[model samples]
Target: MSQIQGWAAQQAGQPLVRSSFDLGPLGAEEVEVAVDYCGICHSDLSMIANEWGMSRFPFVPGHEVIGRVLALGEQAKGLRVGQRVGIGWTAGSCMHCRQCLSGHQNLCAELEATIGGHHGGFADKVRAHWAWTIPLPDGIDLPSAGPLLCGGITVLKPFLAYNIGPTARVGVVGIGGLGHMAVKFAKAWGCEVTAFTSTAAKADEARSFGAHHVVSSRDANAIQAIAGSLDLLLVTVNVSLDWGALLGTLAPRGRMHVVGAVLEPIPVPAFALIVTEREVSGSPTGSPVDIATLLDFATRHDVRPQVEMFPMDQVNAALKHLADGKARYRIVLEGAKG
Candidate 1:
């Protein structure tokens, strides 16, 4: 076993503390990564707070990871020592499942998430299964690539899956970590991007992310202004919303793709969809292939997150910043030596 330093919650509702943990012997299909940076995602906060009720004690919670490959097992291939790499929410998936067999590993029932089912990148080093680790682009730095592992891919994959292109008039609801990325991706794709936020103060920030137009979602007049104008709506907020408000903004045969929180249970008016044949769906994280592609696209287009870096020891302050929406766009924890 290899000994390393990490910050983990000793118990539920407790703050993360520095501790020494063991990394078991590397498996034949595994590679050791020296974690350089890790994003402080909402999921990490949720898990540490035990919001989902499945968090393990002393949990090391961080899925958006970017690091250098320090070592490789005998069977690990296509990756070299000292190469920059990244790992997202998923670590393993049952190869026999239909989704996994079909190449949609994120949909596999037996998939293991980085922070939940396995030890994640909050530690100094993480042993990732080779098949799940992705190579990072040369143009992106480790800190910039950290959030791309999860937040970037989450927004980018749905656009690729739904075939959204130049002609699509896209609406991104919310302007936080996920919504901000949605704006950059949608604009880079040549879509007419409109950002919807309840708070008027976020309008300028939303526009800075590439949204051509920003509207106060709470204002009925503003909401009515865009009725039947959008071809696609990407709801990026976890809070409950009136589905009719969004469905009304869509043009005929429009689609709404959700990839936000797990606890959201919005009441959708069926008539909103039945009348115009609009569709509503959800997306999880992307497949390894999708992530690799997204990394290239992000670098090619300069689509990067505005992140605030914090030391791992300042995790509690970082969490508070994220919760208060004080961070510019994304929050990352550095100082973890993969």
Candidate 2:
């Protein structure tokens, strides 16, 4: 067993505290990683607030982890000690399940999430399954790559799943963390990108992120002007909006993918789908394969998250900053010297 210091919440709605915890002996297929950086995710804030009410107390909340391998178990394969690696939202999944067999590991029924079902990356060190650890490219630093493990891949995989050609017209909704990345990726792919945001202040910021057009989704006229104009709309907002209005912006056979959490239902009119034969889908964080592909693509294209760094001991302040939407984008926690 190994003891390491980390920030954990003793109860829901409480601030995370720096404490020590035991990392049990590694299994044959597991390895111990010395965590270098961890990204604070919006979902982490939700979990800490117990919004979903499934939070496990003494919870160390983080899924976007970048680290170096400290030790590897005997059965661990293809990884070496001191290698730069990362752990995403998934710790492991049932390999024999249909979803896993089909390469849809994210949807596997037996999936073990990094922070939810298992201990996550907010610690100074963690034990992870070998299959879930991905090698970080030498080009990307651990701190910047931390958000890529979650926010970066969450938006990237959905675009990858679409597999659209370079000529595709991509529209990204919302201008926050995920939406900004979506714009950059879409533009880099040689697509004409449009940004949809409710806030007028975000228009210039959206274009700066490579969006070709910035439209206010709040204006009825603005919404109608883009009606049936987009080949793909990536809805990245967590709050519910008029799904029909957004759907109306999709071109024929165009799809709208919802990647954020809406606490309440979005009123979806059945006719909206029936008319254009359009589709709506949702996506979660990526699998290990997806993460690897994203990292490579990001490295090749110089795509990185805008981040604000915080010390590990100030995790509570970090979470509060995230909850308050005060961080410009992502908040990363760096380890403190003992």
Candidate 3:
């Protein structure tokens, strides 16, 4: 490929402009995909603004990618040209590392994020190691399915990791992008699901997403009403909240698992753990097998994200919509038109 056309920001907080760059020769283990659609995640905005201080100039940002395989290297196996596939937060990892060997490749020391140092799915085409270029299952909705690659896996990782069961009582704090998916996954898993949000307007919508209950995340009384009743509390909001009150809602031995990237340190009392054996933990997106499992589960359950769509060329407008918090649940960018 001579030049891969893409939308990129030349500097921090600038609107993405038409840009193209060469990846040169594709590696022996790589696969190139013709991007059809990509989801706009909040983290994408962070990367675009260099908020994490890791943004490289001419940065391309779109990790929740859905497209068809266009090219494959000689060593790329188990995938065919024209096969529909998806790529998430990770594009590649050191295949020889212990984490990769043990099927925990997301934790590999040198994980290559799609938009980190490399180009991402905001392009007409994107490339990843064959392993990270996941095949889309049959009968799945291709447009809205992009978020499943990134945010879906993010919320589902806790259920898979903690071995959450049907009998467990779960709480999802936040009802936007990630939390909504969490509610659906929890309800589909047959767990009793409670969704917490500060906004009263989202309550009914949360329940529509399969939440069994809705409560005020800002109300201390609301948090206390369910005190010690939850088996798992999944925090999906990046903003800080009543940490103690939220933690107090967990049952003995229950876990407070965080998927959101909260910037400040959360203060947890020592006795909070010692007395009830409560735990706090966090995880990024999942591994390849984990992603495949998420896709399969979503397919069987008819779980799909509610999304607003924009033509890929209107990326700046879409970005502003998301930045202004007008995106109802999530947003997807379609491939550029002919």
Candidate 4:
């Protein structure tokens, strides 16, 4: 109803500055959230830099949002005012579409992204369709749960989609954000977990995150040593790696899934797949139901992203920290303070 305050990048590659704008009346199916905390995702940086060539200026970038309902439209359902909730990438969808009807709203042809052509959660307030605003479970620690909305769901969807079992030997490539969560999830699922990373320093840290073993992603010898051992390998980095060597690590009938938004083409030798009957796949964030399941799983297993906190006003510095690759894992912005 009043002017909503936020930080925005007025131009590509520029620092976010304080900005205020009107958020028209709430839609019938929309609910407004008073943001409490918002996770700074790499996707947010990409959007700010116009990396995908789809960004709009005066962009407010945040999608992994943790907040309380401030107001609800008359038609909003299943959530109450003042309820804690988390909103991820998908904000709204054509609810009558086959994808939406089948409970895969993330795949709807007309899905609305939280930060696409709209304001996101890096603000004092934000809004989303009721379906995408999921109530936080009682047990989840709100501060750390923000990343679960995006990075968590991105990695967790592969496990659900591939029917990964407790007995599966899972390898997680990259020891940052999504990769870290993959390790935790695999171990908690009763799988033998292996972490692959280029940085030697992160190996021990990866082990602490539930990785039973760690291997150098760039070392042919180390990568070769684990040949044919993993039932599933989840790649979470956005850079191209030695695909052939990584493929060799998969057991017969194993799968390599990419959750990261790698800009480069992945070169996979046909023989690599033919010889081992291996497969490659990728997925976006999970459906709303899947997010809820992930939250429950995290709560039951006591899994959460390791995070550093910054006030929303210091978003530019936080962005720079992530850009410099200094974030231990993830960063979260405490919403506008009094």
Top TM-score: which candidate number?
3
lDDT for each residue of candidate 1 in 194-252, tens digit (9 for 90 to 100): 99999888899888899999988787788888899999999889887767777899999
Which has the better TM-score: candidate 2, or candidate 3? Answer: 3
Error of 3 at 184 (Å): 1.0
For every model shown, the clashing-pair count is 2, 0, 0, 0
lDDT of 4 by residue, 1-338 (tens): 64789889999989998899898888999999999999989999999999998888899899999999989999999999999899999888889989999988899999999999889989999889999999999989988899999999999998888899999999999999888888988888899999999999999999999999999998999999999999999999999899888989999999999888888899989998998799999999989999999999999999989999999988999999999999889999998641
Better of 1 and 2 by lDDT: 1
Winner by lDDT: 3
Query: Over 4 Å off in model 3, which ranges?
Result: none
* Model 2 weakest 10-residue run by lDDT: 329-338
**2 or 4, which is superior by lDDT?**
4
**Which lDDT values do the candidates have, in the order given?**
0.85, 0.84, 0.94, 0.92
lDDT of 3 by residue, 176-245 (tens): 9999989999999999999999999999999999999999999999899999999999999999999999
For candidate 3, give the lDDT of residue 208. 94
Q: Which stretches of candidate 1 lie over 4 Å from their true place?
A: 262-264, 336-338
C-alpha TM-score for every candidate: 0.96, 0.96, 0.99, 0.98
lDDT of 3: 0.94
